[model samples]
Target chain A: MPVPNRPDRLFRHARSEAIFIASFWLACTVYCCAYCYMYGYITPSRPLTERDVKPIWGVPSWVFWGVFVPWLVCGIVNVVFSAWFVADDDLGEERAAPIADPGGTEADVA
Target chain B: MRDIWRDVLSTGGTRAESAVIFAAEVGSEPKALVALVVFTIASLGLGVAANRFVGREAGFLKKYFLGNRSLGAFAVALTAAVMSGGTFLGFPAFVYAYGWITALWIGSYMVAPLTVLGVMGKRIGRMARRTGAITLPDLFRERFGSPTLGLITSVLVMFFLTCNLIPQFKAGGVIMKKVLPAAATDWATSPPSDDLDIKVDLDTGYMIGLTIFTATVTAYTAYGGFLAAVWTDVFQSVVMAIGVLILLPLSLWSAGGLAAATARGVHDAGIGYAFGPGAGRSFHPITLAVSFFFMWAITSMGQPSTLVRLMAFRDTRTLRYSMIYLTIYNFIIYVPLILIFIAARSVVPGLSKPDEAMPSLVIKLANPYVAGLIMAAPYGAVMSTVSGFLLIIASGLTRDVYQRFLRPHASEKEIALMGHVATVGVGLVVALVALRPPEFLQLIIIFSSAGMAAAFLVPALMGVYWRRATAAGAIAASLAGSGVVIALYALGMLPIEGTIAARLLPANPDIGPASSFRPYYLLGFDPCVWGLASSLVAGIAVSLFTKPPDEARLSLVFDDGPAVEPKFDPPKREVESRGSEEPEAPAEPSATERRNE
Candidate 1:
């Protein structure tokens, strides 16, 4: 097949897909925090302090928290999406190359 | 002075003889040329592999430069580590010459892993995917919505990359001359003699080595582009890690074991405390802390070479892994260097230059072949860094300058070609500049890093998280900060003095010597401090006065939507038809969106 003709369309499609993936990641992260406690894996255990202030001066704490919550959610959603994506690959006709040879010895097997 | 010269002349008829004896006794050059040749070929192979994997015909020039954002953890870590050659070579020398205090501050560069992890890497990856902005300048223009700002940013990047590149060339030349003295003599047109009596001119050696190194790097980088650069960096990083780790134990053994080496160094150089200037009074804990803080802040947040690695990562997950790997790698690398330096000081007292200490120890103390390989460590550092700089400069020119301005409609293939051409052009310019060595590494580091930190750091950080940051503010801040730093330093307002200033810039001294303030000596004063102060003020002041872009428009710049979910909606057919492809169907709408409707 010829390469996608419309660059902007491909980009927009990619972007929209990315957002969905990110949102799903965030949802999963929130779920994990509430139930699984995976937050410990990613963040060092330290009390939040003034020194952790955003590098930009004058940014409010609430604003940072606002960004933080969404960001955390996105991270979780991305993880779940990645797992599903990989699984989808297994279900598809295009088999992944062998893992032993990382240098692309495997090709798409139909 | 006369006696020293007389002793030198009596010892050897010419500088070449002294170099040869020193090189042979120390064993600076040997079959290491084989290793260098092998590494260069491997770099080419990696480049070809990356290009094919990414799909060469992909149309966006940004994807070509950025490897379509499909890079993994290993590639990202290697790229970041290699780009930090400044920290690697410059740190050890600074410690040795200025004292352990200087080294400690420099050593704190390890913080780079955590810093980039917390901020730039994840944000940039998310932003790139969201906006489809291929290069840094593209991101800037898209976020700020101003072409002029993009152009200015591009110029500043080029300047910083050039300055950073010069040192790598110089270091490479230094290694090559040490590794292959006979070849160096032949290249320099010196007469052959048993003693190898040739004049040792630091300037001449630096130039010759730089020319050869630049030529080799330029050839591979120009052809392979980022693919060639990153893969080569990965290999170099591995070699450097192995070489440094191995050299630590071997050199200690050669010096008759770690205990003897430590005792000797202490007897001669003293146990150089991390807080105090061990041999000299150069170390003051407070001053060291200040320098460390500045270096950590500026290098982690501002260095363009490091920032480019963030742009190369495939996703946020890759960034996390890269950061973890880099953090571990840096710690492992630092411990060995510290031990090695301490050992060297004990054994080899009164070394001429700090940069020479590592080489001297390796050659004089270690076995010949091992010494040769160990000395090659710095060569790897230099090449990796230089290639990284070459890639950034080429991308800045091709993607940011040419495609953005000169030829906006150029296809991906054309853009990739231009990128390769730009890499060669940049290498040649840097090679010419490297012909002249500067007075000190500190001068180059402060001048280049401070200039970049002033111009880009505040704007980049604030622009990403703050919706209020305006295009006019970014432009004003960058221009003002860069202009003032350059003008002041050029005028001798900085701590730099006579010969160094003359070498860096040919103008007559505009300010008196007393006006120059060394950052180490001054309290509450340093380039990073002043540069950050000025840029922050300019950026915020300009931003407040200007109206923020409308929310709808601003959302495009600061939205974290794409980063949150994989919302793969096939574009409508009409949108696809405009470009040439048929659009796919839209995926599910979000809960928030459905609620709003």
Candidate 2:
């Protein structure tokens, strides 16, 4: 199947979208980590950074990182794996086969 | 007086005796018999209506497996909520077993509707309307431009759906056994203590009940398609919610009030919250948060049935309403059930299994009528979920596999027929697997959820927001993520024993001892973590090396711009109007123009 026009533009758009998704995911991860710590999943400790300052139900900051970091690392690794697997096939040919109308015209069937 | 009451409550009738007692208690078994018949008839009628309605509106099979993107907010919200059987039945049971803290964790599912509403609901709704993407696999194919990815995703979804359905069937069988036992005259005279295990005659009443329930659900879903399933789900949700609420207060009153129930629970089980005593157990704050986060994330990304709802909506506004309605429904139905579970735990201590607690409590505490109604809730839940799963699987086979691969030019009517066939086929497979029930129904649900979450979550999410989310990447990630989780599970890495892995792996971690490590009992991590990790990594790495999806696809998927105005040629429209008046004039393309590829 023939590729659509504007390859470079498509590449750039795709790149930006990937980054945006990764960022959104990261934000969700951070929120979950903070919530977990507050709920008493880990032992209480002092804050390591300003971003960790918000305490929930009086949970300490250090305990937040204890669970958050490990989870984050695991999440990151998973994200990387997903990206790799999903990118295995060529998008153009795969997409084009279904939508592309070769020779069939509107008049032919009608 | 207390001893007599206790004896009455604790007596465990044998299967033969239980049948007689159940008959006597239920006032001649006719009411129970009538209820079952009524439920089956109602389900079938609604199901046929749903199927026919969708068929008429969608033009046979042109809309084919999908109902032509015609779902409203009410149907979609109910369908998504009812998809998870564990969420409905297990939440109350989890609360009963653990406590408020665990209930809080399970209650976090309430946040799911919000997550979908805030993030994916409107956006997907708009895109689905514009693109006419019927399934999540279809969306993946369109957005990322890859059929391989679509196929892989569909297979993964089917696998998850199958796994999810198994537990529902098992739960149904178990419930039937509990509710109806075979008649035996001699056993009725002597009652066994609660501690004694009562044998159930599964060949007669229990088997018949299970077969009828499964068969009815399967038939309608197979015949009616997605529309039938969704509409019936709304009714099921209503039934389930009403049943649970009614049982809650009555059960509490029987237990001597909420305070007394809590006091009893505290005295018997000690003062630990739902997450268990350890820091990292199932309900541990971190684990709960992570579990909920993953749950929300995975469902948001794919979940074919839920995505189909997005495709069904007329526009984004309707989608918004659906989200709001779903959130309210979850809050009303699920949250209060937690209290009921806790009350049950207080009343019935030392339950052999957590899942059995709610049923046991209802039988012991509530009157026959109330117990019957309450028992209907799980049946409703299981049926709703099973119907939803069967519909999706049928759609995948009919649309993704048959129409997409076998014959692209096949008419909509033909595809619809295929969908019905596929539904029956899938149902048969599920019922067969359910015959040999697993020891832990909850674990099976979790495993399936984790599998789908691992395979599709990252790729689907990224495909929408990131242009670089190539088809290759999505496929690779799904395969790797799902593969790793299954492999690990097979390798005895998880806490589970007696699985394929347990037989292979030596028991001793140090020197090949017979016993192996069970993660839930040892390390705190669930299989979901492993599946998620592998999927995420595979999705990202493959995308980095591969070319990104095209600008058109990306814009179609991610764009939040103003809707494009439909172009109209005045002269062409006039000609078409004139042509329409002529009986045999070549049909104008205008009517079919809006129909999506």
Candidate 3:
């Protein structure tokens, strides 16, 4: 009794969503790895505050690679996701439901 | 963590070295003061002018609360200027004091635009439009048909957001103290030494700044509402950017380039501030770093003031443009800031108080007029944030409480007047509390905002995308999440000196056993992780067992099936398919209408 929609034909919504989430988190994991290996693994496991690390360019090495650059990449990826991937199904004309009745009984008010 | 840093930052530094060489105060202050006065007046003038354009007939509450749901990308972008003030000031201060690991705490801000708008804006904007929900709690009430849930949300957001506002007031005071040190009261005359046992006099500049900030924000927002607030934000954003652009190159130039500055300034090299083992040697513990990383990356979406912008955009394209523009803006403002603060370590070395790093650097490097321009930027940031929150509190008071509970049949005239009255009242309360701030400005900010995010994150997202999410689930999730956060905050506030737990934290004699902020990483984890966990579990568990929302309402919010969220964790209910694909039994008429009738 369910109504078929155009989006379902392109791919399973669940499957597409699953792949996207997996890939995004995977990239995040990759970024974390980049931070650890390149920046030095003195994080959760090592817990060492190596006071002798110098900057690559103007920024510290781990910060440039681990924090700043990775953040840039993540931001760009999120921007792309925002533009192309987001759908307006709930917001579109099909679902432009009217506001709840203003004069509704008191129970609905508070 | 809160009490440790709070006491240390506010009282003095671990090693508050006197300034090696204090720069003579710049003489161009009069010119800069003129510019600041003019700019402030112009902003107020603009606020009053915008009021004429708002048609009062469309229900002033609606027009005021949501700009009549007609915000463009530019308005949305300016509304984000709050990131400029306290963060801009506090971030650099932290960097100057702690060194490299501070990068991780603020570095997470780069993703803020992406999470705030790109992810949450378009969807929530559309949802708010469709459902006629203005405030965040209204979305919950209508979407889930739970007024009780709505009321609880209002109380929770109001509590934490008020806590969040304290920092902005303090930030305003910080800026004032830096620019007009003369304005500071008698107590600030002989500045206190970097001793934990001694209490410093309240800065005269701060008192003046807070008064000015509170008065201006309350005035414009009270008169013009959301649009005025957004418009002022736009102006503030421009001022902030100009200040940073001017200050960035100069600060870098003063520091003798990044390489020299880093080498000369960081005596211990590598900053010793990584998030793993041996961090006692550095500025960070790995546990804290990881917590901060996740916190900033995700929490921006949960802020009610920021999220409300989603409810007002003109259309989907506006949301898109706002995202794109915000990303670019963040880069423009934040990148240089990172460089500027690092350079500050050299330009103005050995300050007893690091929070004065930026303001002090500007006075030393730039002319008085330029300093004023730069000083105004953070003030802009704080004003935008404070005004936005003031409006939110006002809207909450008038619509959620008065209109909903006390005056269900109140006339429009009463509603409009109440809106203005509530804004002033809220502003006054916040300013009064700020007169005697409890801890470091940044510490209070982190506590309040993080708590808000934890409390609302699960419930807001679930209400939007999940079909099976029930009112009971939402109520349970919100209560549980906030409960954990408050409990953790309370525990952190406890005086735990002489206890075995004290071994976990760094030693500071000033706080004695009264600081319960130790034990931040019990079992090697943070409370935020636990708060989030409890929220999700409670929401998912209660909703699955309880009756789902009406099939109609569910279909409306997550139409055409294939919800974006559940794709991560595939829904167990096959009955919840979208667009009638293998539909389950037709749902009973939900309380949406029956309860109304």
- Which candidate ranks first by lDDT, i.e. highest? 3
Instruction: Give the DockQ ranking, best first.
Output: 3, 2, 1
**Native-referenced DockQ of model 2:** 0.06
How do the residues B1-597 of candidate 3 rate in per-residue lDDT, one tens digit apiece? 323443334211211111100111222255555655666686688678768776655656668888877788777865653455544455666666656556555565666655566555655765675455778887877777777888999998888778777655655544444445453444455454222111223545456666886787789888878888788788878777777888888988889987666665555334342222212243344554555445655665677877788787877667667766777777777778778877887788776656677778877888877776766555565666777888998888987898777876677678878999999999998878776766444444555666777778888777765667888899988888767776665556676688765676654322111233432444334557667778889999999999756554555555543221111112355544443432232122222333336
TM-score of each: 0.68, 0.70, 0.79
Give model 2's docking category. Answer: incorrect
> Candidate 2 at residue B149, lDDT?
75
In angstroms, the error of model 1 at B66 is 0.9
Writing each residue's lDDT as its tens digit, candidate 2 over B14-51 gives: 11111222322343244354454555677789777876
Model 2, residue B452: distance off in Å is 0.6
Question: What's the C-alpha lDDT at position B281 in model 2?
Answer: 32
Ranking by TM-score: 3, 2, 1
Residues B347-435 of candidate 1 have per-residue lDDT tens digits of: 66677655456556665666666655544444555566677678878878876667655765565567667877888988888777665
Mind listing the fnat for each candidate? 0.00, 0.02, 0.23
Which residue runs of candidate 3 sit more than 4 Å off their true CA positions?
A1-26, A41-55, A75-110, B1-32, B55-57, B170-212, B268-282, B432-444, B496-519, B524-526, B560-597
Q: Which stretches of candidate 2 lie over 4 Å from their true place?
A: A1-98, A101-110, B1-32, B55-57, B61-64, B83-88, B170-207, B251-260, B273-285, B296-301, B348-353, B364-367, B432-443, B491-523, B555-597
State residue B353's C-alpha deviation in candidate 2, in Å.
Answer: 4.3
The TM-score of the first chain in every model comes to 0.29, 0.34, 0.53
